[model samples]
Target: MKLGISSASVTERYGYDKGFELIKKSGFDAVDVGLEQYGVESDPFKLYHRSEDEFCTFFDTIRKLAEKWELEISQTHGRCNTYSMDKEHNAYVRWVSERDLKATSLLGAPACVIHAIVSGRFPEHYQNLEFMISKNAEMYGDLAPFAEKNNVKIAIETSGRAMVNGREIKGCFSDAPVFQKMFEAVDTRCKTVCVDTGHTNEAVPFGAPKVQELIRLLGKEITILHLHDNNGTYDQHLPPIRPSRGTVEWCEVFETLDEIGYSGVYNFELNLIQFGGVMDEAVRFLGKYLRYFIENKGKLM
Candidate 1:
């Protein structure tokens, strides 16, 4: 249960080298290479523009930098455009995902988290969900071999409701039962789940399962995490500590992780806005607080 964080926010502010330095200075043991899949993108990530060799070389360099600091390249987020409505862009997303698998392998990371498409092609949420699931099965089933060949398992992250067309919509893979269905639908060991704590919390208002119950349902199926906090409605991505940080059922999360023997990284995906501008020191403080409870086996919780 090592402390880790996504490099997206830090890298956006500091670039890769300095961002890696800040991460090391923040007392983290591992990191998730954000392939710039987060946020709305008008175009693909700059890394995706590089030639194949350059992409591989870039990740290799990033991996070496992590090694230089004694930090592990634990996982990566694949480039996925969850908000884009253009079906054509889906083709590019799939292409970049394969490249990401290769880069993830080069980085020595075991998994890559790719988001399912939010196909808002239908009026009802259920209809859109079914379409997304089919698309996921098709896409993942096609890429399963590549994932295995690259030694990078693709993690299907739990989805959250986000604003689209001025209305909130719950997308596919929004809950544990949907996860089970997707697994049944796609027969591949190359795929797994990366449960986002904030997303699951965000679903509570719509009668989704509690975080602990979802943990119990998913159990060992979970191989990674996108740990963060939200206000149980909006996707705030706040630090997972107190001060009404909406890390709901915090004790149950750790307790259930122990029960399931989860050894994966406790990775944070903070948006870096709610900390009152402490910046790097704030990241360090949040990591320290999380480790305190984890190391104490929730006795301190």
Candidate 2:
């Protein structure tokens, strides 16, 4: 597994070019393009309003820059909010997602990550786990053909539990059984799961099927990951390493990956707060983390 990082980690502080430069200098082999927010002057991160011509021009430039820096587009992430009551916002999110599918395809990325819209407070459709599964199936079913046509897969990510609007809301894809149901419900060859470690830690805390069990349940269907560490309480998105930093079981994770024969890029989804926006610090952390991963991978087997 090759090491990769997300552009979202630095794009908020640095422009696209400078961020790509930092990622290259940080020793990463690939980058997950952040389509999460809009940066000034049509950044790839915020690509909601760009016309086809504009998008093509931007993509071409980024492609050239990636080639120059010797980096590959590992995957792309799009924003979605299925729980929102606002029709306009929901429509906008869907529109951007459609555009993101094409944008990811244009970059020649094999897959794009799509978030599961979980419930906020007051129990919306998310109150019914079955409804949530069916909702995701209906939504992704509509996008599967588009994904196949673009030759890009959609990776449905697992989410963390959260308290919103004075109510407790469980994550939609938290449990392995529920996750399997949602994945199976989609019934599309173009869609797969993107397991988020931090979220998994939140879901199965002191439970029957831990992270490794969750992986075992989703074996072969997981094609990507949003690897990160958390305090076992929230989705902190911290760098994966020592136990003091977070509670992720790195050794067990690696062993399970080996068991599943996972050969996809090992990508980290760290938030900038952990490294204080210092590129050198980020590089150092990744170097140590990758060394640990490499030394201990498949040891249990």
Candidate 3:
């Protein structure tokens, strides 16, 4: 597996030009590129809403920068979910999701991480597992054409984020069995799974499968990863904790990957630089140490 991490923090500090170079220097083989839009007013969708050429230029610059640093863009994070009861708002989200696929292809990423359908402004009452599966199947079917057109696959991320409303949807496809069934329901050629360690940890207490079991369940359907550590209660996105000290069992996870023949990027969606260490050395240390811990647990630390 190739070591990878997100370009968000370093890119936030030094912008893309220096960011990719710093990441390459960190010993990472790849990155999980962030395609999330942010700005005041209606400018949030600016990237997705740009003229065709401008959109191409935007992602092209990122792809070129990664290439300049000899780094692969393993995957990208697209729009997470849609909100609001308005049909126009929902349509607008579909538009952004399509652009996400287009941008993923432009960036040379094979997969784009999007969330499963949730209880937002969506009209589907997902309290019933059958209803949730049916709704998500229809949604994936609608998105698959866009995915196929861009020659990129839409990756449905495992969510452990709790719903704020009790009267809304009760569950998502976070459980491994349910997630597997949902995968079978969708068009696999245009869809896959992105196993999120932090979220999986959060889901475990709620009766979802452990990371190892989830890996076995998803098997080859797992095409990408979001590796991070937490305290087993939430999506903390913390740096890799000492082995056997956090929610994830690094040894067991890698072992399971081996057992399942998972050939994918070890991409992190984490705050590895959160401790305020020197940025360059910190990234390097995290990258090197994470792999070392995985490869050799040092007598279980």
Candidate 4:
């Protein structure tokens, strides 16, 4: 497994190019860039503008930087919450997602991770999930060719909220079966799973062993992984450490990945604040752990 950092952690300080540079200089193999808010200090939810040329330019610059730093642009994350609202917002979300998919292709990244809509807006939770999944597939159907041309995949991440009888439910989809159904509905090889460890923990009422189960179920279908830890109640965005009652076992997670021959980057999606203001230290911490696992990966297998 390779080590990577998600740009969301340092978006407050670094722009796309600098963020990739810092991640590379900090000894990470790759970086996950949030394409929607490139070079902006505002949240994607607060921004209403859409410029295709500007987006393309931002990705071009990122590609150049990635080449310069010898770092892989492992994945691209579109704006979260963009797809959770009305028809217009959902259209915008699809437009932006397609743009990112094209950009991901140009940058040589394999996948783009996106969030599912919340269920409360609709009458029922599973119904809403089914609708959102179908809508996403329909909206982005044209981009599959671009994905095919660019050799990239679109990864739908399991979200943290569910809807029950028009009330907001606070958990991810009950299991991998939901994801399997979505994938089957979409009926595209480009669609895959991006598992967020923190979100998986948040979805469970107790321990997050379901995360391992999901990986096992999805197996080779999992194209990307957001590797961060949480203390069960909230998304702590902590770096991988020893697992506790609430969190997942770091070593076991790696072991399972090894068993499945998952070659994707284990992108660290932790918050920089939790690292005590030292980005290098955070990178080193993750690198040490990942190196230990990679070196022992064969033995574990």
Give me the displacement of residue 145 in model 3, in angstroms.
0.8
Residues 1-301 of candidate 3: C-alpha lDDT, one tens digit per residue: 5888988778867889898988888788999887765311455556655688988998899899999999999999887765345677667767778878888999999999988776443444545667777667776777789899889999988766456354422246667787778778886588889998888877777776788888888888888999888887766787775643467776788888889888888887877556565776788787787677556732245
Q: Candidate 2: where is the Cα deviation over 4 Å?
A: 39-47, 83-85, 206-208, 298-301
Each candidate: what lDDT? Answer: 0.75, 0.74, 0.77, 0.67
Candidate 4 per-residue lDDT over residues 1-301, each given as its tens digit: 5778887666456665676666777678888876666423464632324465665665677788788989888898865654444778666666666666777876778888866444444444455566756755664464567666667887878655454675544543535676666666665667778888887776666322456777777788787888777776676777655444346565566777877879888787777766656865666566666556546742334
| Model 4 score (lDDT) | 0.67
Per TM-score, the best of the predicted structures is 3
Better of 2 and 3 by lDDT: 3
Candidate 4: residue pairs that collide:
none
Which whole-number lDDT from 0 to 100 does residue 120 have in model 1? 49
Stretches of candidate 3 off by over 4 Å are: 38-45, 83-85, 119-124, 164-170, 243-245, 276-278, 297-301
User: Which model is ahead, 3 or 4, in terms of TM-score?
Assistant: 3
Worst 10 residues of 1 by lDDT: 36-45
Q: How close is every model to the real structure, measured as TM-score?
A: 0.88, 0.88, 0.90, 0.80
Give the range where candidate 3 is weakest over 10 consecutive residues by summed lDDT.
Answer: 161-170
Across 182-273, the per-residue lDDT of candidate 2 in tens digits comes to: 88998778988898888888765535256777888899998888888888877788776553658777778888888998888888887765
